[model samples]
Target: MKALVLAAGTGTRLRPVTHTGAKQLVPIANKPVLFYALEAISAAGIANVGIVVEPNADDIKKAVGDGSRFGVDVTYICQEQPLGLAHAVLVSQDFLGSDDFLMYLGDNYVGGGVTSVVEAFRHDRPSARILLTQVPDPTAFGVAELDDTGRVASLEEKPTRPKSDLAVMGVYLFTSEIHEGIREIKPSARGELEITHAIQWLIEQGRDVTATVNTSYWRDTGNVADILEVNRHVLDTTEGPGAAAGEVDPDSTLIGEVHLEEGARIVRSWVEGPVVIGAGTLITDARIGPYTSIAEDCRVSGSAIRSSILLSGSTVDGVSAIADSLIGRHASITTAAAGGDSHRLVLGDHTRIALAG
Candidate 1:
């Protein structure tokens, strides 16, 4: 089987970070979001992969060059316009000819990867397989309504009044019949070929379309909040029991599940985890709290921060407190004021901000 990853969407929500880079290349826990999907596809035992990209999205190509890093050979399929999922499949016909393949969204995070679901689809050989999970607002997502036997009876894209809470996930497994389904569907009201419509078309044809209700974790990291949330989940789930493998001083204190990457140093500081410090980062005389990830080469001195993401090469100096913030790459945040309180920030790349401390 092969894999098809869609990476062409211009992430308007995550600007101006996406202004300089592809949304798929955004890092969570110091690893690119697109890498997670590629690794998952590779873990599912799919070797040959196709990545659908816009003509201008070269960052994806440069970062994932040849896909050998993820143990997969990738073929770049160019989509001239930002159509839609079904349109992407239609354009990738040459690379995906006559092969069953897994379709993954580049920014979606499915906890525990796609190995089990791929194995299930390979055994059952369904015309199409989709994963669904409950979401609070079904109207914000394409939802699946299942029949008594748990087969996908119908699909609605962002319905005003959803029939069920089962929101469709970004991962899918499909046989060659999906190509015909895509061909039979027309552009939606949004002027794009909707994948839900094509899946509904397959169901109407009496094809074996399956739906699996996933109770585990899945998220589309399209915005800052979701990115931080996914980072917390990844760190908490994977980083077992705190380890001070880095150059932490004896005067420092580490609590909970903290993970200090190589060359990271915590000098005369206190860190309460579920926190991860990336390689070469320095935390001196600072208080690092939970649900925070400091990327590589960052510096946080004489500051207190919680529930924030400090991107690579950033610096935070003498801040009283920072909460629920996203400090971008190479950004510098400092406090010159004599007195200050907790602040919430969403700085972009290379930003410089000075607060009154």
Candidate 2:
């Protein structure tokens, strides 16, 4: 079987960050979220993969290359616009051909990978199979209604009144019969051909459709909170036995599960983990708390940070007590030279602030 990974969507919800970068490229624990999808596809033993991308996304090409690194031979199919899931499949018909394939959203995060689900799809050979997760807000997702026999009975794309809470995940396995369904359904009220509608079309035609509820971790990282949450979960599960490959000064202390990448230096600081410090970052006179990830080439000094992500090249100095925040790349965050009772901040567009001083 082949695979089609959709990476062309414009992440409107993750503004400012998505304005300059692809949402799929957002890092969780210093690893691109798209890489996790590609890794899952490669692990499933599907080597023939087609990635649907924007008209001219060289950044994605540069990051993923030919997919040889991930054990897949990638064919890049350009989607003219950020249409919809069904439209992505329709455009990838040339690359997908007649093969049974998996369609994975490049920005979604599925814990433990999709290997076992792929195996089940291969064995059962359902005409269409969707991965579902019970979400608190079903209105924000394409939801599925399953029968007592576990077959998918109906599907709805972000319905105001959802019949069920089983939100369809970003992954789906489908045979060529889905192509017929995609062609049969009209664009929804949202002006795009949603995959849920196509699957619903198949159900109307009496095709065997099924779903697998992902009891394990699964999140759609379209916003900052979700991204940070996924990052924390990934670090807790994957950081494994800590390896401080980088230099740790005698004055510094590292505790718990901490993985320091090569060239990362810690001086006169204390860092506790489930945390990962990326390559070449320096930590001085800081207290790095658990569930935080500091990306490469960053500097953190005289601060206490917990549960935050500092992107590449960001500097945090003097200002203390940060939590549940995402600092963008090359951004410098510091206090004014003179100490004051009143707080002062130079904020950017879409910047959220809660002063604790």
Task: Put down candidate 2 lDDT per residue, 1-357, tens digits, no spaces.
Answer: 999999998878777666666789878999889999999999999999898999768878998999999989999999998778999999999988899999999999999799999999999999999999998899989989999999999998888999999999999999999999999989888789899999999999999999999998988888889998999999989845365488899998888888889999999999998889999999999999799998999988988888877778888777767788777766677766555333333222334343433
TM-score per candidate, chains pooled? 0.95, 0.94
lDDT of 1 at 186: 90
Best-performing candidate as measured by lDDT = 1
Reference-based TM-score, model 2: 0.94
User: Which ranges of candidate 2 are over 4 A from the true structure?
Assistant: 337-357
lDDT of 1: 0.91
The lDDT for every candidate, in the order shown, is 0.91, 0.87
The TM-score, computed over Cα atoms with residue i paired to residue i, of candidate 1 is 0.95
Supply candidate 2's per-residue lDDT for 187.
84
- Residue 123 of candidate 2: its Cα lDDT? 98
Which pairs of residues collide in model 2?
none
**Number of backbone clashes in candidate 1:** 3
